[model samples]
Target: MNTVKIGWIGLGKMGIPMSQHLVKAGYPLNVYNRSKDKEDAFKAQGIGSAASPAELIQHTDVVFVMVSDDKAIDDIFTGENGLLKPEVSGRVIINMSTVSPAISKEMAAKCIAQGNHYLDAPVSGSVKQAEDAALVIMVGGDATAFEQVKPILEKLGKLAMLVGDTGAGNTAKLAINTLLGIVAQGLAETVTLARQNGIDAEALTTLLNNSALGSPLIKIKGEAIVNNNFNAAFALKYIAKDLRLAKDMGADTPLAQTAYKTYQDAEAALGEEDIIAVIKHLG
Candidate 1:
């Protein structure tokens, strides 16, 4: 792992911590971010900085991307400085963004045509999990490429499973996120109903945490909802985006559809808040 030359694109919430883990694990790290400050910050830590994705590709054997959406991914990899440019080949590009599986398939095809390897490996976790290197990563694409990077990925996640062929990772991620959106909404509604019926919000939250219904997500988000701490661990807008993608993919997601609208409404008022802030839309 230490001998692998790794490059990272995207330096947002999850990206920053995930990349930090790679650097700490002693992989030869290079990074590029559209924001100069983020790039410079990593450079100051002794990691190499690339002027663009094209340049980053020149120096690294594997490039990991954790950008926001399909548009962002396209912007970084389709322009003059794009990763798919003629000069970039024979490298592994691992996309860890939660995006449409269709888009992932398209990108994988393009990369493979250019003599590159692509893996759609999106993670299931929030900022805390990223920081603690406890994320669960779902991967797809060539089994050989997956094995090559499995050791590196393990340094950033507790579990890394190759779900299927290209785009399957994104499919799995969307499926998991659908459950996340629905459960989050359910928890929000349940807590709000308890408060409305004159039950103590904090006590109800504690009771739920100690019950079989308790999950790590419910326990963490439940505390946030009760205390009204809406600081973003995972932004509500991103959750809304994932739900929208799930809908676009024909998932028959009625519950996710309702949860999507709830998140969209909450985003209008608390766009930058934690996903748990969807509780604010309750009652």
Candidate 2:
């Protein structure tokens, strides 16, 4: 077994279960979260908790960060108490957060300048999937760094791969999410419309399940419409955030602008819910 001692940042819905899988796999982990109580799962799993990023940096081999966004990524990696302080060298930072490709590029530069390695490794899966260790992971970084971290990543996901470099993975994730948002919103609108026309959504869903457009995206997510439960596996706020990123991408491609507007409209309709609930905006 590769004794790469573990370090993780963030402990949200996704982070908690992933950390559980890490410790259960018997890798020594030192985890840190901004909110103290968020660190409970790590502690419960016998993984050590750090009072701050600096302390956490002091204790591990590779640090896996599943933080919120670019700002949080900056604060943790380059903040005063950031892990990439002048003194620390030879550490690897794996970001599992979905961030802008530009930011990922900048982060890679900072890590290299500071003699550390950085990898952008985002994932696709709901919280339940995360708990079950079945997420599809996309990685981009220095090949050696990815090789070093691949084994640890395996503990957190079922499918994992190093795509291109630094920002490539983030770009891929954004593209994938953008399409998902479109289809999910499309599903939401189609069903809601069919219902308004006196068609039973359940029956429409049954038919769609066998149609060419029958995608697992609809199969798994169309149920959210059938049952008005919108507890987030992927939150509305985050999808809105992603569309904002899409808008940036839109500068180069107008379609992205339309998608951003779509997400904005969706966010307006449903203040907050699972991302799939964006369909609620269709009415």
Candidate 3:
């Protein structure tokens, strides 16, 4: 196979290792980051650097964006020095960012108008899973483009599923995050209550991991909370962002109203720390 020339935008906690994994696997990569310090790790990996989005667009056949939110994606694609404004062709932009479904749809249409393909390939996993290539990816948009990129995507994720048409990935990811918040709230609240009553948090986590109701999420995230590791496997800010997206989509689910309020309280208490920091609020 000809090495796929990839334009990797965003070099945060997840994006850094994801791009590094691709580089380690011998993919031709050109990386761009709004923050220079974050790019330092990749720079040591012999990845090419682009000072601007347009410069980055010049060097690749595909653009893999693992950014913050809709605004960050919009800025890269349609900002003053937007990638879309450059003279480019034969490109596919796979956004692994968990953005709003509405924004994903709009960006996909924009890519089509510019004669490029787009995929809303939002992911399920944190920075740790991302580094380990253990993420469950949720993708939506053109099937042909997805097929063409499946090899690369597989290298980055363990379970890459096609959910539906344009915007479906973001929609699914947001829905997942909403429920994840609720589950985290329940887990944290329960563990804190137990700990307060003299139950060992670690023992409870191990017990739950072996129980029918246990999941990989609770096992790993619960362990983090038990250890008081506030390292950003996933941040409260990102979860809060997804909760807001869920609230917009939850017109049919009034119960989601309650979860959103809980996330709001937790975020305020924790100052937008890691997902495990929600347990701090509970404690």
Q: Which candidate should be chosen as best, given lDDT against the real structure? A: 1
Give residue 58's error in model 1 in angstroms.
Answer: 0.7
For candidate 2, write residues 121-220 as lDDT tens digits: 9998878789999998999989998887788888888998999988878888888888777777778888888998999878998899999989767887
Worst 10 residues of 3 by lDDT: 250-259
CA lDDT scores, all candidates in order: 0.90, 0.82, 0.84
lDDT of 3 by residue, 1-283 (tens): 3488998998888898888778877889888999888777677867678898888888899999988988998999888787888857679999999999888888888888988889999888887788899889999998898899988898898988888899999988988888888888888888988888999899899889999979988888888877788877788878878888888876336557766776677777674577768877766
Off by over 4 Å in 1: none
Question: Largest TM-score belongs to which candidate?
Answer: 1
Q: Where is model 1 poorest over a 10-residue stretch in terms of lDDT?
A: 251-260
**lDDT digits (tens) for residues 145-199 of candidate 1:** 9999999999999999999999999999999998999998899899888988998
The backbone clash count of each candidate, in order, is 0, 0, 0
TM-score of 1: 0.97
Q: Record all residue pairs in model 1 with backbone atoms less than 3 Å apart, i.e. clashing.
A: none
Ranking by lDDT: 1, 3, 2
Worst 10 residues of 2 by lDDT: 250-259
